[model samples]
Each structure stands twice: as C-alpha cells, then as structure tokens.
Target: MGLYDRYLALRVRTTDAAVPEHVALVITERDLLEQGAYDTLRDFFAWAFEYGATDVTVYVSVLDRAAAPTLARELEDLDAPREVAVRQPDDVERADAPITVGIGLGGRSEFTAAIRDLATAVDDGDLDPDDVDETAIEDRLVFPNDPDLVIKTGAERLSDFMIWQSVYSELYFTDVNWRDFRERDYLRAIREYQDRNRRFGE
Candidate 1:
C-alpha cells in the first residue's frame, strides 16, 4: 500500500459512522473492454473487503445481446478475491456468492420479469393478488441483495441496475473511468460512505 492509500484506509478505519457492509458497482461493457479492466475489478474487490465490505455486486451494462455470453465468460474467469457468480439477463436464479456480477440485465427488464412471475403465480392459484407485495417482487429478483452503498464510475447516472434493491442505498459517483480506477479511489468511496448519515429515505 502506498502512503496515500494508507492514509485513506486510516480515515475509513477511524470514521465514527459505520462502513457499508454491502457495496455495488455500476459499469458498462465498454469499460471492461479497456486495458487492465479485469485487474481493476480484482483490486476493487480487495479494497472492498479490506475496508469491511462483506458483499460486492457489479452490474455491467451491455448494448449488444451478442456480447453477453463473452462478457459473462470473462467476468466469471476473473482472478478475484472471492468466488463470483455471473448472471445473464434471462437468468432469474439467485446469485449467492460473496461477489455477484450481472451482465446486460437492465432494471426495467428485471422488474417486468418479476411482475410476470407474480402474475403467473396469481393465475395458478398459488398466490393471491392481494398477497403480492414488495417481498413478492424481491423474491423474484436475480440479484436480490440490497446494497448499503452503490458506486458508479465515469458517470453520475446509474446504469439501470438493482432498481428494486438500491432504493435506499447511499450512491457515490466519480468521474474517474474504470480503467483508471485505483485503490485510493475505492478508499475514497469508502470514506465518503462512512461520512454519510444514512436516512433510508426518511
């Protein structure tokens, strides 16, 4: 660790506020195409875990459906700190690993699919329409873990990810692109998150 990185880590460790346990990152497929993108991701996981994050979720937006398979394969093969679960757009199965990656799965499509599943259950007499609620919707989500903090690099806008889960997450946006992201950037995000007085929309 460099001196500045050590300083940022010290700040995060000494903060009065609680650090985020679950962290989410938003990036595009183009970002991963850049040189050393996977190395950046590996470092990100290391930083997250080092600073008290227990779970990490990465949402990679893809404009082309044909690229989904290749992206998934690459992400799954990343030499990360922990086990990774990579899910495609049509994959509804829950990802239970410490690190989860979602490729090409927009939030709108996920919500639509959840609603479709709810409707099917209602029609089949397995669940009543009146019983359907937030839990019902969440149960049908692919990556259902709600993050305490969400980080978006290179843009202020979220890349249509974890709409249902991130309703109360503290968001951190940085102009730094994915390829240039460093451990200091990750620590800065942790420090920012630690400084916030999280009021879950209250």
Candidate 2:
C-alpha cells in the first residue's frame, strides 16, 4: 500500500465513528462509458469490504432503457471480489448477495411496484391494509437493505436512488468522476463519514 493509503487506513482503524456495514454507490451510465470505469468499480468493492462493509449496493442510473441490457452484461463481467447479483429495472425479485447491482432500476418505479403488489394482496384477502407498513414494502424491494452510507460520484443529485431505504442513511457526494476514482478516494469518503454526527432523521 502507498504511504498515504496506509495512513488513511490507520486513521479509519483508530477512529471511534461507527463503520458502515452496508454501503451504497450511485453512478450514471455515462460515467461507465468512460475508460477504466469498471476497474474502479472492482477496486471500490475491495475497499468497501476492507473498510468493514459487509454489503455493497451499486445503482447505475440509465437515461436510455435500451442500454440497460448491454450495461448489465458488462457489469456481470466485472471481476468483483464478492458474488454479484445484477438486477434489471423490471425485476421485482429480491437480491441477497454480498454485492447487488441495479442497472437502470429506478427507485420510484420499484417502490410503486411494491405498493401495487401489496394492494393486490389486500384485494386477494392475503394482506390487510393496516398491515401494509414499511416492512411489507421492504419485503418486495429488489435491494431492501438500508445502507449506512450512500456515495454518489460525479454528481450531487441522488437521481432517485433508494427512496424507501435511505431515509436515514448518511450520504456522501464527490465531484470526482468514476473513471478517476481510486483507493485514496474511497478512503477519503471513509474519513468524511467518520467526521459526521448522524441524526438518523431526528
């Protein structure tokens, strides 16, 4: 490891701030089009796990729906450190791998679909309206785990990621583009998260 990277690792190891077990990353399709972007993503997964995150969620926002399939195939080809489960926009199945990648899956659409499923269950006498709480909604989401920290690269806008899950999660935004992201950048994010006093929606 580089001298600066070792120093950052030591800082994280010595800090009192709680390390986020589940970390989420939001990037755009355009960002992936850049050279060496996939390599950065693999490094990101390694860093997250090395820094104590057990689960990593990656959301790749898409402007053109047609590009989703191509993107999914490429993401599946990534040499990630952990098993990766890639879900497309229309998929309603739950993902339970250590790494979950959502390609062009809009958070609003996912939430709306979950609500629709609950309503259908109610009409079928399978569920009661009163029991349609947050858990009910979460049970149907593709990526249901609420991340402790969400990182958005190259942009500040959330772009509709994890609407139901991230209500209380701490968010970190960086101007650095995905292709240019490095291990040091990930460590910097960890350091920044350590400095925050989270209120958890208080």
Candidate 3:
C-alpha cells in the first residue's frame, strides 16, 4: 500500500462506522475490453477482502446480448483470490460464492423471471398467490445476497443493477474508468462509506 492508501486504510480501521461486509461493483462490458482490466479485477477482490469485506459482486452490464456468452467464459476463468460463480441472463441456478459475477443479466429481467415463475406455479396450483413475498422473490433470483456498498466506475449511471436488493445500499460513483482504477481509489470509496450515516431507506 502507498502512504496515502495506508492512511486511508487506518482511518477506515479506526472509524466507528462499520466496514461494508459485502461490496458490489457496477461496470460496463466495454470496460473489460480495456487492457489490464482483468488484473484490476483480481486486485479489486484482494482489496475488498483486505478491507473487511467477505463477499463481492461484479455486475458487468452488457448492451449487446451476443457478448454475454464470451464475457461469461472469460469471467469463469478469472484468476480471483476466492472462488467465483458466474451467471448470465438465462442461467436459473443461483450463484452463491465469495465472488459472484453477473454478465448481461439485468435486475429487471431477473425480477420478471422470478415473478413469471411464481405466476406459473400459482396457475398450476403448486403455490398460492397470497404466499408470495420478498423471500420468495429473492430465493428465485440468481444472486440473492444484498450488497452493503455499491461502487460504479467511469460514470454515475447504474442502469439495470440489483433493483430489489440494492434498494438500501450505499452508492459511490467515481469518474475513474476501470482501466485506471487503483487501490487508493478503492480505499477512498471505503473511507467515504465509513463516513456516511446509512439510513437503510428510512
């Protein structure tokens, strides 16, 4: 860690505010095309875990549906510090790992799919419509764990990302692009998170 990074880490460690246990990153599919982008991802995982985060989620929003399969294959082979579970739009299996990657899978699509499943069950007399609740919806989603902090790089826009789960998450947007992201940038996000008073949608 650099001198300033160490300082920020110390501040985070000494602050009364809680460190984010689960950190989520929102990036675009084009961001990955940049050189050294994958290295940044591996380093990002290390940084998140070093700063007291146990789980991390990377949402690689895709504009072209055709890119999903190639992106998924690359992410599955990432040299991450922990085990990773990669999920795309059509994947019904839930991705529950220390590191979960979502490629081309928008929250709206996932939510709608879950709702459609429940509707089908109700129609078949397998599940009652009145019994459906938050847990039921979450259980059907690909990645169910809600993030404590969500960081969006390059721009402030966070389209189609965790619509239901991130309702109460603290958001941090940085202008630095994915290729230029560094440890200090991540530490700054953590510092900012610790400095805030989260209301959890109060």
In candidate 1, what are the lDDT values of residues 51-124, reduced to their tens digit?
A: 89899999999899889999998988889899999999788787899999999888888889999999999999
Show model 2 residue runs off by greater than 4 Å. Answer: none
- Winner on lDDT (1 vs 3): 3
RMSD of each: 1.0, 1.0, 1.0
Per-model TM-score, in order, reads 0.97, 0.97, 0.97
- Between prediction 2 and prediction 3, which has the larger lDDT? 3
Candidate 3 ranges with C-alpha deviation above 4 Å: none
* Overall lDDT per candidate, in order of appearance: 0.91, 0.91, 0.93
Q: Encode model 3's per-residue lDDT on 1-202: one tens digit a residue.
A: 7888889889988988899999999999999999999999999999999989999999999889899999988888988999999998888688889999999889999899989998998999999889999988998988899999999999998899989989999999999999999999999999899889999989
Q: Where's the lowest-lDDT run of ten residues in candidate 3?
A: 1-10
Residue pairs clashing in model 3 are: none
- State the lDDT at 89 in candidate 2: 76
Give the total clashing residue pairs for model 3.
0
The CA lDDT at 132 in model 1 is 100
Cα error, residue 13 of model 1, in Å, equals: 1.1
